[model samples]
Target: MEDGKLTVRAVERALDIMLCFTGATELTLTEIASRVDLHKSTVHRLLASLEGKGFIMRDAATDKYRLGYRLWELSANLSKEGDPGIILLPEMERLRDQLGETISLYVQDGLLRVRIQAVQSNQAIRRVAPVGARMPLYVGASSKVLVAFAEPALHEKLLASADWPTGLDQQAFLQQLSDTKLAGFATSVEEREPGAAAVSAPVLDRGGRLVAALAVSGPANRLTLEVMQEQAPLIMEAARRMGTMLR
Candidate 1:
């Protein structure tokens, strides 16, 4: 247990050092130590280990450290076969460019909806939901879409067995899912986070099985319920393309 804790702590410090390079092309040893608030010798040792693994490299001529090729190569692999991001990223980018909002992809994980990929808006005041977050299946537009198209047994189990939030009417929620399935999309205004709103549509595989939910979200002041309603057709089209690409 002691050894494991030490290993984890070392990993955390290394990550802190790497994060100091964010938005920076290169950083000197002194700059890294200052950013992470660690001793010069400690920072140097951590940097040496990271450099050995190709996670970071120090330029001998300039004495500055920068991200290495290993990170870039690993990032490139996200687009390879069997990754959902590969099929959805192009459409996500197009939507972000056209709608000027955050585009995210979510898949149902058990009874919860987990964000798997995201293309955040470049706007200064934008909504940002972290990827890999497990959100409630009963709230938010993306969650509604995922639930609407979920497998019948699992869907029923979620409704009957899962603990629901207070003041949520069960019958009304079921009706909402029915409506979403009929319209092939879902829209919400400030259902999850205050001042945040989103619209989502279901993406199905070639066999017409529910695969994921593609959503566009932003500040409620800009991306209103009306705007999302008007843009539903386009969102649906993009989701359709995403579904088609999934084997």
Candidate 2:
């Protein structure tokens, strides 16, 4: 094969690895190697480079790999596709500055929540829910708000589907979603990821339609439930301000 073909094949394999994570957000090295049908050594090198470039991240506790934070910075820029989220960048940055934590924007797509934009915190130990990564709609703070504020059809579809991960109490989960909708916000501590906590609120358009869930996430130690509660108003205000910037 020509060198060009080899390079293209290499890029395709890397992309395959990224797509495989859609089904399994957290996967061990062996699991990924098996799923991608690649030699462990080859996959290891790809993962290493990807991690270095902030395209993938490894969980220290579980030794598993997941998506990382740099995708939006690379692809969601204003010029490339002109993502609507760019208009809210100033508000996201201000919230990050005021809260000292990662700020993320998540929009509901069917039963999934995709991180469309984010402004990460400066802390050395921080949570990284990668931009463009698809997350479970029934797991985290952002997910709760997204699901709660979603259209009734999509919301009911989620409630009826068996897509929810095991070990979750469906009854309590339903109640939580109800509360989130009523309160116009949600909070989670180590719910989606261990040692990570987040607070989230719905972003609504001028027509009173849900646009996204704006969130602040960081290490659980720093963003304890109490601290998040105290700062909840800040995020809610920022989310509302961002919503007004949109249609």
Instruction: Choose the strongest candidate by TM-score.
Output: 2
Per-prediction TM-score = 0.69, 0.71
Error of 1 at 213 (Å): 0.1
lDDT (Cα, 0-100) at 34 in candidate 1: 93
Instruction: Compose the digit string of candidate 1's lDDT tens values, residues 170-218.
Output: 7888888999999999998989889999999999888999889999999
Model 2, position 232: C-alpha lDDT score: 86
Model 2, range 130-165, lDDT digits (tens) per residue?
A: 777888888999999988887778767886778866
Models, CA RMSD each = 6.8, 7.4
- Report model 1's TM-score to 2 decimal places: 0.69
Poorest lDDT segment (10 consecutive residues) of candidate 2: 75-84
Clashes of 1: 0
